[model samples]
Target chain A: MIFDLVIYVLIGIGLFFNILAGIGLLRFPDVYTRLHAGTKCTTFGSIFLIGSVILLGLKMWWEKDTNGSVLALHSALALVAILLTNPVGAHAIARAAHRSGIKPAQAVIDELSEEPMNVTTDERRGGD
Target chain B: MIDVYSTYLIVVIALSFCVILAIVRVLRGPTAPDRVVGVDTINTIVIVSMVAFGTAFREIIYIDVAIVYALLSFISTLFIAKYLQGGEF
Candidate 1:
Protein backbone atom coordinates (compact mmCIF):
# COMPACT_ATOMS: atom_id res chain seq x y z
CA MET A 1 0.00 0.00 0.00
CA ILE A 2 2.72 2.43 0.95
CA PHE A 3 4.68 1.40 -2.11
CA ASP A 4 1.87 2.58 -4.31
CA LEU A 5 1.67 5.84 -2.44
CA VAL A 6 5.35 6.50 -2.92
CA ILE A 7 5.10 5.84 -6.62
CA TYR A 8 2.09 8.14 -6.94
CA VAL A 9 3.85 10.96 -5.17
CA LEU A 10 6.95 10.65 -7.26
CA ILE A 11 4.95 10.63 -10.46
CA GLY A 12 2.99 13.68 -9.37
CA ILE A 13 6.13 15.63 -8.60
CA GLY A 14 7.70 14.67 -11.89
CA LEU A 15 4.64 15.73 -13.85
CA PHE A 16 4.51 19.05 -12.07
CA PHE A 17 8.11 19.96 -12.92
CA ASN A 18 7.74 18.77 -16.50
CA ILE A 19 4.72 21.01 -16.90
CA LEU A 20 6.64 23.87 -15.39
CA ALA A 21 9.41 23.30 -17.91
CA GLY A 22 6.94 23.58 -20.75
CA ILE A 23 5.49 26.80 -19.40
CA GLY A 24 8.90 28.31 -18.83
CA LEU A 25 9.93 27.50 -22.36
CA LEU A 26 6.94 29.40 -23.70
CA ARG A 27 7.07 32.38 -21.38
CA PHE A 28 10.81 33.07 -21.13
CA PRO A 29 11.94 35.79 -23.50
CA ASP A 30 15.55 34.88 -24.18
CA VAL A 31 17.37 31.75 -25.34
CA TYR A 32 19.50 31.64 -22.20
CA THR A 33 16.51 31.92 -19.89
CA ARG A 34 14.57 29.39 -21.92
CA LEU A 35 17.57 27.08 -21.71
CA HIS A 36 17.48 27.58 -17.98
CA ALA A 37 13.90 26.33 -17.88
CA GLY A 38 14.02 23.82 -20.70
CA THR A 39 17.16 22.04 -19.55
CA LYS A 40 17.26 22.06 -15.77
CA CYS A 41 13.57 21.52 -15.04
CA THR A 42 13.24 18.64 -17.45
CA THR A 43 16.42 16.99 -16.17
CA PHE A 44 15.27 17.22 -12.57
CA GLY A 45 11.80 15.98 -13.51
CA SER A 46 13.18 13.06 -15.49
CA ILE A 47 15.19 11.96 -12.48
CA PHE A 48 12.00 11.64 -10.46
CA LEU A 49 10.00 10.03 -13.22
CA ILE A 50 12.67 7.47 -13.98
CA GLY A 51 13.37 7.00 -10.29
CA SER A 52 9.77 5.87 -9.87
CA VAL A 53 10.19 3.41 -12.69
CA ILE A 54 13.31 2.10 -11.01
CA LEU A 55 11.38 1.60 -7.78
CA LEU A 56 8.61 -0.20 -9.64
CA GLY A 57 11.12 -2.50 -11.29
CA LEU A 58 12.75 -3.23 -7.97
CA LYS A 59 9.34 -4.06 -6.54
CA MET A 60 8.75 -6.54 -9.33
CA TRP A 61 12.13 -8.09 -8.76
CA TRP A 62 11.41 -8.43 -5.05
CA GLU A 63 8.48 -10.57 -6.03
CA LYS A 64 10.92 -12.86 -7.88
CA ASP A 65 9.84 -11.85 -11.35
CA THR A 66 12.71 -12.69 -13.71
CA ASN A 67 12.37 -9.68 -16.01
CA GLY A 68 12.30 -7.13 -13.23
CA SER A 69 16.09 -6.96 -12.90
CA VAL A 70 16.38 -6.20 -16.58
CA LEU A 71 13.80 -3.50 -16.24
CA ALA A 72 15.49 -1.92 -13.27
CA LEU A 73 19.01 -2.15 -14.63
CA HIS A 74 18.13 -0.85 -18.08
CA SER A 75 16.06 1.95 -16.65
CA ALA A 76 19.02 2.92 -14.51
CA LEU A 77 21.11 3.01 -17.65
CA ALA A 78 18.62 5.31 -19.29
CA LEU A 79 18.50 7.58 -16.27
CA VAL A 80 22.27 7.77 -16.24
CA ALA A 81 22.28 8.74 -19.87
CA ILE A 82 19.88 11.56 -19.12
CA LEU A 83 21.87 12.72 -16.12
CA LEU A 84 25.11 12.80 -18.04
CA THR A 85 23.84 14.22 -21.31
CA ASN A 86 21.35 16.89 -20.32
CA PRO A 87 23.75 19.26 -18.59
CA VAL A 88 26.51 18.85 -21.15
CA GLY A 89 24.04 19.54 -23.96
CA ALA A 90 22.74 22.59 -22.15
CA HIS A 91 26.23 23.97 -21.65
CA ALA A 92 27.10 23.44 -25.29
CA ILE A 93 23.95 25.16 -26.46
CA ALA A 94 24.46 28.08 -24.11
CA ARG A 95 28.02 28.56 -25.29
CA ALA A 96 26.94 28.34 -28.90
CA ALA A 97 24.15 30.87 -28.36
CA HIS A 98 26.50 33.37 -26.74
CA ARG A 99 29.17 32.87 -29.38
CA SER A 100 26.62 33.28 -32.17
CA GLY A 101 25.75 36.78 -30.93
CA ILE A 102 22.63 36.19 -28.81
CA LYS A 103 22.86 38.31 -25.68
CA PRO A 104 20.87 37.88 -22.52
CA ALA A 105 17.74 40.01 -22.62
CA GLN A 106 17.55 43.01 -20.26
CA ALA A 107 20.95 42.41 -18.77
CA VAL A 108 22.95 45.46 -17.71
CA ILE A 109 26.35 43.77 -17.79
CA ASP A 110 27.89 40.58 -19.11
CA GLU A 111 31.25 39.49 -17.73
CA LEU A 112 31.99 37.22 -20.66
CA SER A 113 31.71 40.18 -22.95
CA GLU A 114 34.82 41.64 -21.35
CA GLU A 115 37.03 38.72 -22.28
CA PRO A 116 38.72 39.02 -25.68
CA MET A 117 37.93 35.50 -26.72
CA ASN A 118 38.10 33.86 -30.14
CA VAL A 119 34.75 35.34 -31.18
CA THR A 120 34.58 37.18 -34.49
CA THR A 121 34.53 40.98 -34.62
CA ASP A 122 30.86 40.95 -35.61
CA GLU A 123 29.96 38.72 -32.64
CA ARG A 124 31.99 40.96 -30.29
CA ARG A 125 30.12 44.00 -31.58
CA GLY A 126 26.80 42.21 -31.11
CA GLY A 127 27.76 41.35 -27.55
CA ASP A 128 28.48 45.01 -26.89
CA MET B 1 -8.68 2.69 -6.02
CA ILE B 2 -7.37 3.53 -9.46
CA ASP B 3 -5.37 0.90 -11.26
CA VAL B 4 -1.64 1.61 -11.36
CA TYR B 5 -1.57 0.75 -15.04
CA SER B 6 -4.15 3.41 -15.70
CA THR B 7 -2.07 5.88 -13.72
CA TYR B 8 0.91 5.24 -15.93
CA LEU B 9 -1.25 5.93 -18.94
CA ILE B 10 -2.36 9.20 -17.38
CA VAL B 11 1.28 10.19 -16.87
CA VAL B 12 2.01 9.55 -20.52
CA ILE B 13 -0.97 11.62 -21.56
CA ALA B 14 0.15 14.52 -19.41
CA LEU B 15 3.64 14.32 -20.87
CA SER B 16 2.13 14.48 -24.33
CA PHE B 17 0.52 17.74 -23.30
CA CYS B 18 3.93 19.00 -22.24
CA VAL B 19 5.29 18.06 -25.63
CA ILE B 20 2.56 20.14 -27.22
CA LEU B 21 3.56 23.11 -25.12
CA ALA B 22 7.17 22.80 -26.22
CA ILE B 23 6.04 22.54 -29.83
CA VAL B 24 4.24 25.84 -29.47
CA ARG B 25 7.50 27.44 -28.41
CA VAL B 26 9.32 25.85 -31.30
CA LEU B 27 6.78 27.30 -33.68
CA ARG B 28 6.66 30.77 -32.17
CA GLY B 29 10.33 31.21 -31.27
CA PRO B 30 11.91 34.07 -33.22
CA THR B 31 15.50 32.88 -33.05
CA ALA B 32 17.35 29.72 -33.97
CA PRO B 33 18.70 29.13 -30.49
CA ASP B 34 15.21 29.59 -29.09
CA ARG B 35 13.89 26.88 -31.39
CA VAL B 36 16.80 24.62 -30.49
CA VAL B 37 15.97 25.05 -26.82
CA GLY B 38 12.44 23.91 -27.52
CA VAL B 39 13.67 20.88 -29.38
CA ASP B 40 15.99 19.96 -26.51
CA THR B 41 13.12 20.17 -24.05
CA ILE B 42 11.02 17.94 -26.29
CA ASN B 43 13.77 15.30 -26.38
CA THR B 44 13.95 15.09 -22.59
CA ILE B 45 10.20 14.74 -22.21
CA VAL B 46 10.10 12.05 -24.87
CA ILE B 47 12.69 10.04 -22.94
CA VAL B 48 10.56 10.16 -19.79
CA SER B 49 7.44 9.20 -21.73
CA MET B 50 9.19 6.20 -23.24
CA VAL B 51 10.16 4.97 -19.78
CA ALA B 52 6.62 5.46 -18.49
CA PHE B 53 5.22 3.59 -21.47
CA GLY B 54 7.63 0.74 -20.92
CA THR B 55 6.51 0.47 -17.32
CA ALA B 56 2.84 0.54 -18.29
CA PHE B 57 3.23 -2.26 -20.79
CA ARG B 58 5.92 -4.29 -18.97
CA GLU B 59 8.05 -4.13 -22.06
CA ILE B 60 11.80 -3.96 -21.40
CA ILE B 61 12.52 -3.17 -25.02
CA TYR B 62 10.91 0.22 -24.86
CA ILE B 63 13.25 1.30 -22.08
CA ASP B 64 16.19 0.05 -24.10
CA VAL B 65 15.01 2.11 -27.02
CA ALA B 66 14.71 5.10 -24.71
CA ILE B 67 18.34 4.77 -23.70
CA VAL B 68 19.43 4.66 -27.30
CA TYR B 69 17.23 7.60 -28.14
CA ALA B 70 18.64 9.63 -25.27
CA LEU B 71 22.20 9.13 -26.45
CA LEU B 72 21.38 9.93 -30.05
CA SER B 73 19.49 13.07 -29.08
CA PHE B 74 22.45 14.25 -27.02
CA ILE B 75 24.76 13.82 -29.97
CA SER B 76 22.37 15.70 -32.19
CA THR B 77 22.11 18.56 -29.73
CA LEU B 78 25.89 18.84 -29.61
CA PHE B 79 26.18 18.91 -33.38
CA ILE B 80 23.55 21.60 -33.63
CA ALA B 81 25.32 23.65 -31.02
CA LYS B 82 28.60 23.28 -32.85
CA TYR B 83 26.95 24.34 -36.07
CA LEU B 84 25.66 27.45 -34.39
CA GLN B 85 29.12 28.21 -32.95
CA GLY B 86 30.22 28.95 -36.53
CA GLY B 87 33.87 28.07 -36.08
CA GLU B 88 36.05 25.34 -37.53
CA PHE B 89 35.13 22.04 -35.92
Candidate 2:
Protein backbone atom coordinates (compact mmCIF):
# COMPACT_ATOMS: atom_id res chain seq x y z
CA MET A 1 0.00 0.00 0.00
CA ILE A 2 2.81 2.38 0.78
CA PHE A 3 4.50 1.63 -2.50
CA ASP A 4 1.26 2.27 -4.32
CA LEU A 5 0.91 5.64 -2.70
CA VAL A 6 4.49 6.44 -3.55
CA ILE A 7 3.83 5.56 -7.18
CA TYR A 8 0.88 7.93 -7.26
CA VAL A 9 2.96 10.71 -5.84
CA LEU A 10 5.76 10.07 -8.29
CA ILE A 11 3.41 10.10 -11.24
CA GLY A 12 1.78 13.28 -10.01
CA ILE A 13 5.10 15.04 -9.69
CA GLY A 14 6.15 13.84 -13.13
CA LEU A 15 2.91 15.05 -14.62
CA PHE A 16 3.40 18.50 -13.15
CA PHE A 17 6.89 18.81 -14.55
CA ASN A 18 5.76 17.63 -17.97
CA ILE A 19 2.92 20.09 -18.06
CA LEU A 20 5.37 22.79 -17.11
CA ALA A 21 7.61 21.69 -19.96
CA GLY A 22 4.78 22.07 -22.44
CA ILE A 23 3.78 25.47 -21.15
CA GLY A 24 7.37 26.63 -21.10
CA LEU A 25 7.82 25.50 -24.67
CA LEU A 26 5.05 27.80 -25.76
CA ARG A 27 5.60 30.65 -23.32
CA PHE A 28 9.34 31.11 -23.53
CA PRO A 29 10.77 33.85 -25.69
CA ASP A 30 13.49 32.16 -27.71
CA VAL A 31 14.93 28.86 -28.79
CA TYR A 32 17.33 28.67 -25.86
CA THR A 33 14.61 29.37 -23.34
CA ARG A 34 12.31 26.88 -24.99
CA LEU A 35 15.12 24.37 -25.01
CA HIS A 36 15.56 25.06 -21.30
CA ALA A 37 11.90 24.24 -20.76
CA GLY A 38 11.70 21.28 -23.09
CA THR A 39 14.93 19.61 -22.08
CA LYS A 40 15.17 19.99 -18.30
CA CYS A 41 11.49 19.65 -17.51
CA THR A 42 10.95 16.48 -19.51
CA THR A 43 14.16 14.97 -18.22
CA PHE A 44 13.04 15.67 -14.65
CA GLY A 45 9.57 14.37 -15.40
CA SER A 46 10.86 11.18 -17.01
CA ILE A 47 12.95 10.37 -13.99
CA PHE A 48 9.95 10.30 -11.71
CA LEU A 49 7.44 8.76 -14.07
CA ILE A 50 9.77 5.96 -15.06
CA GLY A 51 10.82 5.61 -11.46
CA SER A 52 7.22 4.84 -10.61
CA VAL A 53 7.32 2.02 -13.10
CA ILE A 54 10.46 0.68 -11.53
CA LEU A 55 8.87 0.79 -8.11
CA LEU A 56 5.79 -1.02 -9.30
CA GLY A 57 7.93 -3.71 -10.85
CA LEU A 58 9.93 -3.97 -7.64
CA LYS A 59 6.81 -4.26 -5.57
CA MET A 60 5.53 -7.05 -7.73
CA TRP A 61 8.92 -8.72 -7.67
CA TRP A 62 8.80 -8.61 -3.90
CA GLU A 63 5.65 -10.69 -4.22
CA LYS A 64 7.73 -13.27 -6.12
CA ASP A 65 6.45 -12.71 -9.60
CA THR A 66 9.27 -13.60 -12.01
CA ASN A 67 8.00 -11.25 -14.73
CA GLY A 68 8.26 -8.44 -12.24
CA SER A 69 11.99 -8.85 -12.09
CA VAL A 70 12.26 -8.51 -15.82
CA LEU A 71 10.13 -5.39 -15.78
CA ALA A 72 12.15 -3.81 -13.03
CA LEU A 73 15.52 -4.53 -14.57
CA HIS A 74 14.46 -3.43 -18.06
CA SER A 75 12.94 -0.25 -16.77
CA ALA A 76 16.20 0.53 -15.08
CA LEU A 77 18.02 0.05 -18.35
CA ALA A 78 15.55 2.31 -20.14
CA LEU A 79 16.05 4.92 -17.49
CA VAL A 80 19.78 4.64 -17.97
CA ALA A 81 19.39 5.22 -21.69
CA ILE A 82 17.28 8.33 -21.09
CA LEU A 83 19.66 9.65 -18.49
CA LEU A 84 22.70 9.27 -20.69
CA THR A 85 21.35 10.67 -23.93
CA ASN A 86 18.95 13.53 -23.20
CA PRO A 87 21.56 16.02 -22.10
CA VAL A 88 23.89 15.25 -24.96
CA GLY A 89 21.15 15.90 -27.50
CA ALA A 90 20.15 19.09 -25.73
CA HIS A 91 23.72 20.34 -25.77
CA ALA A 92 24.04 19.59 -29.45
CA ILE A 93 20.82 21.43 -30.20
CA ALA A 94 21.92 24.48 -28.22
CA ARG A 95 25.25 24.63 -30.00
CA ALA A 96 23.53 24.23 -33.36
CA ALA A 97 21.07 26.97 -32.49
CA HIS A 98 23.92 29.31 -31.64
CA ARG A 99 25.86 28.47 -34.76
CA SER A 100 22.83 29.02 -36.97
CA GLY A 101 22.83 32.70 -35.95
CA ILE A 102 19.85 32.82 -33.64
CA LYS A 103 20.89 35.47 -31.17
CA PRO A 104 19.65 35.41 -27.61
CA ALA A 105 16.53 37.44 -27.05
CA GLN A 106 17.25 41.01 -25.92
CA ALA A 107 20.88 40.29 -25.35
CA VAL A 108 23.46 43.08 -24.96
CA ILE A 109 26.77 41.37 -25.57
CA ASP A 110 28.08 37.91 -26.39
CA GLU A 111 31.59 37.01 -25.28
CA LEU A 112 31.60 33.69 -27.11
CA SER A 113 31.90 35.30 -30.48
CA GLU A 114 34.66 37.70 -29.49
CA GLU A 115 38.39 37.08 -29.99
CA PRO A 116 40.50 37.25 -26.84
CA MET A 117 42.40 40.51 -26.29
CA ASN A 118 45.87 39.08 -25.61
CA VAL A 119 46.34 36.51 -28.35
CA THR A 120 49.97 37.58 -28.85
CA THR A 121 50.73 37.18 -25.13
CA ASP A 122 49.04 33.79 -24.98
CA GLU A 123 50.75 32.48 -28.09
CA ARG A 124 54.42 33.36 -28.29
CA ARG A 125 54.52 32.51 -32.01
CA GLY A 126 51.98 35.28 -32.67
CA GLY A 127 54.46 37.87 -31.35
CA ASP A 128 57.37 36.40 -33.29
CA MET B 1 -8.83 4.16 -3.65
CA ILE B 2 -7.81 4.83 -7.20
CA ASP B 3 -6.88 1.68 -9.09
CA VAL B 4 -3.47 1.41 -10.75
CA TYR B 5 -4.80 1.38 -14.29
CA SER B 6 -6.97 4.38 -13.60
CA THR B 7 -3.99 6.30 -12.27
CA TYR B 8 -1.99 5.32 -15.31
CA LEU B 9 -4.83 6.46 -17.51
CA ILE B 10 -4.88 9.84 -15.82
CA VAL B 11 -1.14 10.17 -16.16
CA VAL B 12 -1.24 9.20 -19.82
CA ILE B 13 -3.95 11.72 -20.53
CA ALA B 14 -1.96 14.45 -18.84
CA LEU B 15 1.07 13.54 -20.89
CA SER B 16 -1.03 13.65 -24.03
CA PHE B 17 -1.93 17.19 -23.12
CA CYS B 18 1.75 17.99 -22.93
CA VAL B 19 2.33 16.43 -26.33
CA ILE B 20 -0.44 18.51 -27.83
CA LEU B 21 1.10 21.68 -26.48
CA ALA B 22 4.42 20.67 -27.99
CA ILE B 23 2.73 20.10 -31.33
CA VAL B 24 1.35 23.59 -31.17
CA ARG B 25 4.85 24.88 -30.71
CA VAL B 26 6.04 22.87 -33.64
CA LEU B 27 3.37 24.25 -35.88
CA ARG B 28 3.74 27.86 -34.77
CA GLY B 29 7.42 27.97 -34.12
CA PRO B 30 9.10 31.19 -35.23
CA THR B 31 12.29 29.53 -36.30
CA ALA B 32 13.68 26.13 -37.24
CA PRO B 33 15.43 25.55 -33.95
CA ASP B 34 12.22 26.26 -32.09
CA ARG B 35 10.52 23.57 -34.11
CA VAL B 36 13.35 21.20 -33.33
CA VAL B 37 12.93 21.92 -29.66
CA GLY B 38 9.25 21.09 -29.92
CA VAL B 39 9.98 17.84 -31.68
CA ASP B 40 12.57 16.84 -29.10
CA THR B 41 10.11 17.53 -26.31
CA ILE B 42 7.48 15.43 -28.01
CA ASN B 43 9.92 12.57 -28.47
CA THR B 44 10.72 12.53 -24.76
CA ILE B 45 7.07 12.69 -23.79
CA VAL B 46 6.31 9.80 -26.12
CA ILE B 47 9.09 7.67 -24.68
CA VAL B 48 7.84 8.20 -21.14
CA SER B 49 4.29 7.55 -22.21
CA MET B 50 5.35 4.27 -23.74
CA VAL B 51 6.94 3.19 -20.49
CA ALA B 52 3.89 4.27 -18.54
CA PHE B 53 1.60 2.31 -20.80
CA GLY B 54 3.84 -0.69 -20.54
CA THR B 55 3.65 -0.50 -16.78
CA ALA B 56 -0.10 -0.16 -16.82
CA PHE B 57 -0.45 -3.16 -19.09
CA ARG B 58 2.17 -5.24 -17.30
CA GLU B 59 3.86 -5.90 -20.62
CA ILE B 60 7.59 -5.20 -20.56
CA ILE B 61 7.91 -5.00 -24.32
CA TYR B 62 6.61 -1.47 -24.48
CA ILE B 63 9.32 -0.30 -22.19
CA ASP B 64 11.90 -2.00 -24.33
CA VAL B 65 10.48 -0.24 -27.33
CA ALA B 66 10.79 3.00 -25.44
CA ILE B 67 14.45 2.37 -24.82
CA VAL B 68 15.00 1.90 -28.51
CA TYR B 69 12.96 4.99 -29.24
CA ALA B 70 15.12 7.04 -26.92
CA LEU B 71 18.29 5.89 -28.62
CA LEU B 72 16.93 6.49 -32.10
CA SER B 73 15.55 9.89 -31.22
CA PHE B 74 18.86 10.91 -29.75
CA ILE B 75 20.55 10.06 -33.00
CA SER B 76 17.99 12.00 -34.96
CA THR B 77 18.33 15.01 -32.71
CA LEU B 78 22.10 14.96 -33.15
CA PHE B 79 21.78 14.76 -36.89
CA ILE B 80 19.30 17.62 -36.95
CA ALA B 81 21.67 19.66 -34.85
CA LYS B 82 24.52 18.93 -37.16
CA TYR B 83 22.49 20.04 -40.13
CA LEU B 84 21.49 23.20 -38.32
CA GLN B 85 25.11 24.02 -37.56
CA GLY B 86 25.87 24.11 -41.33
CA GLY B 87 29.35 22.69 -41.28
CA GLU B 88 31.25 20.51 -43.71
CA PHE B 89 30.42 17.01 -42.66
For this target, which candidate reaches the highest DockQ against the unseen true structure?
A: 2
TM-score of candidate 2 relative to the true fold: 0.92
User: Could you give the CAPRI-style class of model 2?
Assistant: high
Q: What DockQ results do all the predictions give, each relative to the true complex?
A: 0.85, 0.87
Q: In CAPRI terms, where does candidate 1 land?
A: high
True contacts kept of each: 0.91, 0.89
Candidate 2 lDDT at A126 equals: 62
Tens-digit per-residue lDDT, B1-89, candidate 2: 77876688778889999999999999999899999999999999999999888877888899889999999999999999999999887
**Tens-digit lDDT track for model 2 on A19-76?**
9999999899999889999989999999999888888888889999988898889988
Candidate 1 lDDT over residue span B58-78, tens digit each: 999999999999999999999
Q: Clashing residue pairs in candidate 2, if any?
A: none
Strongest candidate by lDDT: 1
lDDT of 1 by residue, A1-128 (tens): 99999999999999999999999998888999999999889989999999998998899899999788898999999999999999999999999999999889999879798776656778979999
lDDT of model 1, residue A59: 91
